[model samples]
Target: MRFLVDECTGPAVARWLEEKGHDVFSVYDDAPGIADSKIIRRSHEEGRILITNDKDFGGKVYRERSPHCGIVLLRLGNERGQNKISVLRRLLEEYAGRLPDQFVVAAAEQVRFASKEE
Candidate 1:
């Protein structure tokens, strides 16, 4: 799976994602200082899911139907790389394989999946 990690996410997370063979790009390196909407659009255009701690994306992508290959809205209290990696690992282990068709949110206490009916 391809991913576009937000600047809030640390470098180790990016490296581990790449080590897993996913084409992962950090917003800091690729879309540095870009707006959320633009990042969402870019991720969609690149066929990559977005990993972000910000909740605004959930509203933008799910409520407004913003373009995104997929959405993984992370909610890690501590922004440390290790915590992020652990949360990411659990999320991927649980749903990355069986991910649904639309935007998804991986929160600290819950994992929410939303998709439009075909």
Candidate 2:
């Protein structure tokens, strides 16, 4: 899988994704301080699933109707990198094949999929 890890999502999660053999573009490491709109556009253009903790992206995709390859929105209460990784690990383990073109919200205990048309 290919991923664009949002800067707020941190480098640790990006590194862990790399260790899991995914092609990763870490905004924190690669392009710091880029705008959220550009990040989403770039991720869509590059066919990369975006891993982000930013809730503003929800408005971008749902309300503004921005294009995206896929988006994994981590809505964890913990907000720590390890917790993010654990949620993502479970998400990929169970839903990898179903990810593309979807808006997915992963919490500590559950995963929710939102329709693109919604």
Q: How much lDDT does each candidate structure score? A: 0.78, 0.95
Give one digit per residue, the lDDT tens place, for model 1 in 1-118: 8888887665688888999999998986766778888888888888888888878987786578786677777776777888888888888988886453466766677887777331
**Please, what is the TM-score per model?**
0.86, 0.98
Task: Write down the lDDT that model 2 would get.
Answer: 0.95
Candidate 2, 52: how far from true, in Å? 0.4
Model 1 ranges off by over 4 Å: 116-118
Top candidate when judged by TM-score against the true structure: 2
Provide the lowest-lDDT 10-residue window in model 2: 109-118
